[model samples]
Target: MRYGLTFLALSAALAALAVLAGGAALVLLWPAMSFGLVGAAYLARRPALLGKRPDGTQAAWALVLLGPYFLLTWATWRAERALGRADCANEVVPGLWVGRRPLGDELPAGVRLVVDMTAEFPAAAAVRRHPGYLCVPTLDGTGPEVERLRELIERLRGVDGVYLHCASGRGRSATLAIALLLERGLAADVDEVEAQLRQRRPGIQLNAAQRELLRRARARPGA
Candidate 1:
């Protein structure tokens, strides 16, 4: 019994370690590493679970632990699958999407939308006249445009998608858009989204930091 308990404890410890490592990796990779730690845990415990018939108490204990585990793992997978092609960081709020250039027509209903207005292709500036839309200064991830993005999100009802110019599709605007979506509720799969954007918009460009930020933003619950 003591040995069994020790083994269980060890598994839990290893799971914790995996979570840290996987979570760190996923912050920059998005869905790439979301389930890595959880998968590791299940693999670690599989041998023990198969070794004997779990009795009532042990079964109950297993239920307590595995129930939440399964739920989180399943949810993570669902999020990853659903958000595979979604652009933006991890913390984007509840709702948002990425649409084609000249975005207004393709936006989803009840979703707040924005687009780039700068001259730079693939990475540009926010439209100065547009009050509630998200835009950026350059593909390099600099400028004051980022500060006002939160205000824009706060003023909006629901975010559908942020549109981008075909040339400047993957710059600071994309990162900011992803951040706002995460602030609203989108998954941080910026990498996948960016990849798709590049394919769709051949000349689109994005710098490393903006790309990194897109994968790391965590969603703000109830925001």
Candidate 2:
């Protein structure tokens, strides 16, 4: 939050500079300021970040920067998609998979559940027909909401297919896949599972906080 706000203020200052200096300054700093706003929107995503507001009223506050935020994220998503070889989910376990936000009809045939772990953007069209769509709006680098971690771990089970995703299918979605593995006893060792995930999805990774989530999740009954 601190860094995001700093960038927001910095971007505003840069915009002011661009307007005042004009010409060369305007040309270079305008694009720089635009990028900074996008960074600000991504970093300070919490609903309460503004005046410690209520948990669910971020829309009105976020309207100001939605333009740049969507443009940058969508562009990044497209760049990643364009460079990738496949658009569909990559199965880690038989019933579980990880991938970027599904577009159009990219969800696998048996995917009965779609768990989205990103707060950046919405991509529900791919999962529109699936009834068990879950939105665990999470910050980019953070783990799932700890208060609901247990519930999320449970929800990942008993389904024929659970399709999990984030911005790049590398972190958040991969972390959920790790939770499913441990929660369901499909895998016990986090190291081994991570290694396996990397083999299937070469870019998959989990952060410190997300690794902590997997640690706590493994302490479940009979787990």
The root-mean-square deviation over C-alpha atoms between each candidate and the true structure, in angstroms, is 20.5, 5.1
> lDDT per residue, candidate 1, 27-136, as tens digits?
32322232333243333423233111211012343344344443543465447546656433221223533332232343344444454423222221222233445443
Candidates' lDDT values, in order? 0.39, 0.69
lDDT score of model 1? 0.39
Error of 2 at 134 (Å): 1.4
* Poorest stretch of ten by lDDT in candidate 2: 47-56
TM-score of each: 0.32, 0.75
- Write one digit per residue (lDDT tens) for candidate 2, span 1-223: 5546655776777778888989888864654555475555547555222211122223554444454555666798888889887545788878788998887578887887788776666655545445767777766666665546778877666777888888788888888787777667766688888998888888887777778877776675455
Q: What local lDDT score does residue 62 receive in model 2, on the 0 to 100 scale?
A: 47
Q: Which one wins on TM-score?
A: 2
Off by over 4 Å in 1: 1-114, 117-146, 153-157, 192-205, 212-223
Clashes of 2: 0
